[model samples]
Target: MPTSPSDTLQRFYTAFSQLDHATMAECYAPEAEFDDEAFSLRGRDQVAGMWRMLCSATRKSGAAHWKLEFRDLHADGLQGRAHWEAHYTFSATGRRVHNIIDAEFTFNEAGLILRHRDRFSFWRWSRQALGLPGLLLGWSPSLKRQVRSTAANNLRKFLALPPA
Candidate 1:
């Protein structure tokens, strides 16, 4: 039987909480799209790779530095929404960050996520992740674009790597 949209979202976030990128990947349709403050991506491989990279970093930071909570889930038809929070050490700056995000999702007929978007405050995130520079330029469009570019490059490099 096909999964419900709510169940798919729940499984995705639950897998994320456990740092299980493989399970997270399973939640996406093969042509899925994802967007967030730092990155915008198309295709499940890219989206899943982003999750894998993040989960790997969180795992390396140790369990003490990583936490995830999700709630307020709602689904109607093929659409769903949820609120979540993530606490993790930013790998780039070794700074602690607590990010609150609201996510919207559209599901395919098979109940996999076809499109997922996460909204969060870039200014708040930058202040925590980038320290002084973030405090000064977090609200700037250029800074946001730069962050997206850097993240895309990082993901590209990661995708080029041979699988473990």
Candidate 2:
């Protein structure tokens, strides 16, 4: 049986909390597009790759733990939204980061996520993730561009690595 949008979201969150990238990827359609403040991805491969990179980054950090919390999920027709947060320590800074995100999703007829966009305050995130530099320049557009560039570079590097 096909999953409903809410069911798909629940599965996505469950998979994510368990660092199950494969299951998380299955929540999306092949042509899915996902965008956040730092990374923008098109297609399932890129989106799934992002999750792999992030989940692995967290695991490798050792000093940080990742937690996922979500509530108020609602779906009607082909759209859905969720309020979620990722609580972890920023790898580089080792500072605690509580990223509050509002996710908007569009589902295909089969209820696969076709598009997922996450909105959050970059300045707020930067302050927690980058510390002093983030506090000083997190609000700058240039900072946002730099962060995006770094994210894209990280994604490329991750994609280039041989599968384990």
Candidate 3:
């Protein structure tokens, strides 16, 4: 009577598609970690908070749709990868942006996700979504360095927090 990693991943994806932060949080281990270009977060509370913020922002921005397509699922199901596309209108400018990202997830024996990592090109993302300003700013070497530093700092803070 043990849960499979694929089952856990499926549940996680279902929760994410529904924007069900609580259920999504439940799919992660208490001490799990998630990382992407923007930031890294540790623990269920921090991950839940990140999901809440993202969902709230998406809603506020009048997102039309968000979907994930699984590209590959390992046979053992210890790991998997997916492609995601999100359509939303910018709250400030009312411009529509389509964000595409590739994500990889890893699970532990308990069927809880231990790590989730996302890979994407910020420069291309900024240019396509935010236009010239984003293109110039995002591609700048200095800005990229700052972004990485900020993400590390955020991760450290999340790891330092007391468990909820």
Candidate 4:
């Protein structure tokens, strides 16, 4: 039987809470797309790689600590939405972060996710992650673009690294 949207998301979140990128990747289709305040990614490889890069970085840092929570999940046919929160240390500045996000998803015919978009406040996030600078310019389009550029660059660098 095909997976229900709620079940697929539940599985995804379960893996996320454990920082299990492989399992998270399993929730997406080969051509899946993902986007958020930081950056956008297309194809399963890029999307999955993002999670792997993040989880691996945090784990290797030895200072990694985080939590994920999801609620208000709703699904209709191939679409789903959920309210989630992420609590973690911002790797760049070693700042504690509590990010609240709303996620929308679209599923492929095989019951795998084809698109995943997370919406959150860059201003709120910047204040926590970038501190003074974010407080002053978090709402600036330039600042937001810079953040997205940096994140994409970082992901590219991570993707370029050879397999362990």
Candidate 5:
């Protein structure tokens, strides 16, 4: 029997907490879609690659430098939702960020995630990650676009690297 939607969500978040990007990626279906404030990605490869990149970045910050917490997970039929938070240092500025996120997911019949959307305040996140610049421009559309562009470029660079 296939795993239930709730079980899949639990496994995904658990893997994230452990910085197990491979397992987190496995939770997504082959054609999964993922979107958030800074990224809009389609297909499991893009989604998985993003997780791999992020987990790698988090790991380099040291195990004690970052933490993840998740709760309020619920699934009904093919849909699921969860609340998660991450406390970590932003590698760019060495600034500490405590990000709160709410996530929604749609699962395939096999319980792999078919779609994942994470919602968070970009202004809030920017304020924590960018320090003075964020405080001055976090709410501006230009700033948002710049962040998105930079994130996309970074992901592209990461994907270009040869497999380890």
Candidate 6:
């Protein structure tokens, strides 16, 4: 029997709050896809790796605190959205960045996530959270294009890697 989408979503959020990578990985279907502003990753392994990287970076930067306020849950437990905040110090600049973001999720049968997306404005985000560098560099069309392209390439590479 399949778990309800709401149940799956709750489990995912709990796992994320706990930073339980194994549990987080289990919440995704084998071929689940995730698209954030930074990259698009497909498959459980790739998504898991992305989470691992994010967790590591978060820990390293002392920004592991994640507070998720679920705004809505629907789609017969298959879809939902939430508002979240992440508080952390930037590893590169040691700047404390508090980011407010919106996240949405869709789950497949077997209680796994099929699609996950995060919404945020890169230009506004870069300028506000990232400071002068973000303000100056983020607005450059060339830089933005490069960032997107590089993220896509990285996701492809991650997907190509052998599963752990």
Better of 1 and 3 by lDDT: 1
TM-score of each: 0.97, 0.96, 0.75, 0.95, 0.97, 0.77
Give the TM-score (vs. native) of candidate 3.
0.75
Runs in model 3 deviating more than 4 A are 65-77, 90-94, 145-164
lDDT by candidate, in order shown: 0.93, 0.90, 0.69, 0.90, 0.93, 0.70
Pairs clashing in candidate 3? none
**Which pairs clash in model 1?**
none
Residues 1-164 of candidate 6 have per-residue lDDT tens digits of 67777777677767776667777888789989988767677888788887766665566666444444444544555776666666666554566666666878887767668898988777766665568878888777776677668656765665576654
lDDT of 6 at 27: 78
Extract clashing residue pairs from model 6. Answer: 5-77, 6-77, 63-88
Cand. 6 TM to true fold: 0.77
- The alpha-carbon lDDT assigned to residue 81 of candidate 4 equals 94
Candidate 4 or 1, higher TM-score: 1
Task: Give the winner by TM-score: 4 or 5.
Answer: 5
Prediction 5 TM-score vs. true? 0.97
Per-residue accuracy of model 3 over 1-164 as CA lDDT, tens digit each: 35777777677777777767678888888888888876677887677777765665566566465444444444266776666665666443565666677878777777787888888888876665557776789878776677668656654564476644
Model 1 lDDT at residue 137: 100
Query: What lDDT tens digits, residue by residue, belong to model 5 across residues 95-129?
Result: 89999999999999998899999999999999999
As a whole number from 0 to 100, the lDDT of residue 149 in candidate 1 is 94
Candidate 3: lDDT over CA atoms? 0.69
> In model 6, which regions exceed 4 Å deviation?
63-77, 139-141, 149-164
Residue 70, candidate 4: alpha-carbon lDDT: 85
Candidate 5, poorest ten consecutive residues by summed lDDT: 57-66
Candidate 6 to native Cα RMSD, angstroms: 3.4
RMSD of each: 0.9, 1.3, 4.3, 1.3, 1.0, 3.4
Which lDDT value does model 4 have at 5?
84
